[model samples]
Target: MKHHDLEILITTRKFFACDAESTEEAVKIATTEARKHLGQDFYSLEIRDPSAGWPETVHEATNPEIT
Candidate 1:
């Protein structure tokens, strides 16, 4: 893959964060450390999964400031 500085957007139900770094360095770090913690199952790891679909559509919208 082409090496570039990029940001990884990581998300969970309760939290989200972005990791910004060079891709080549990031892959080296990710592969090295993840293997230590996850063992041979490193490839199938999942951090979290939130709602699997879109939120219910709201017909009426209300401004939080006005409420």
Candidate 2:
């Protein structure tokens, strides 16, 4: 069998409610929370092989009602 190495990219978006006094503080808190909960909220996925060229998107989640 042949083996290959590939890179995967995951895109996620989530909303967080924080008791912060400033926008900067809110962003910090949200970033911390998001890092702690990685891989739990993903809306898109992409894969690419270094040996190959550009990355290819495999999955994407879209909400028609939001637009």
Query: Which portions of model 2 show Cα errors greater than 4 Å?
Result: 39-67
Task: Estimate, for each residue in 1-67, the C-alpha lDDT of model 1 and write its tens digit.
Answer: 7989865434323232335385445444544454465443223322222333444321222223321
| TM-score for each candidate, following the candidate numbering | 0.28, 0.48
> Which pairs clash in model 1?
none
Expressed as tens digits, the lDDT of each residue in 1-67 for candidate 2 is 9999876655544445769896557556655655465545443322223233435332233333332
Best candidate, lDDT-wise?
Answer: 2
Instruction: Score residue 63 of candidate 1 by CA lDDT.
Output: 28
Q: What is each predicted model's overall lDDT from 0 to 1?
A: 0.37, 0.48
Clashing pairs in 2: none
Where's the lowest-lDDT run of ten residues in candidate 1?
58-67
> What's the CA RMSD of model 1 in angstroms?
19.3
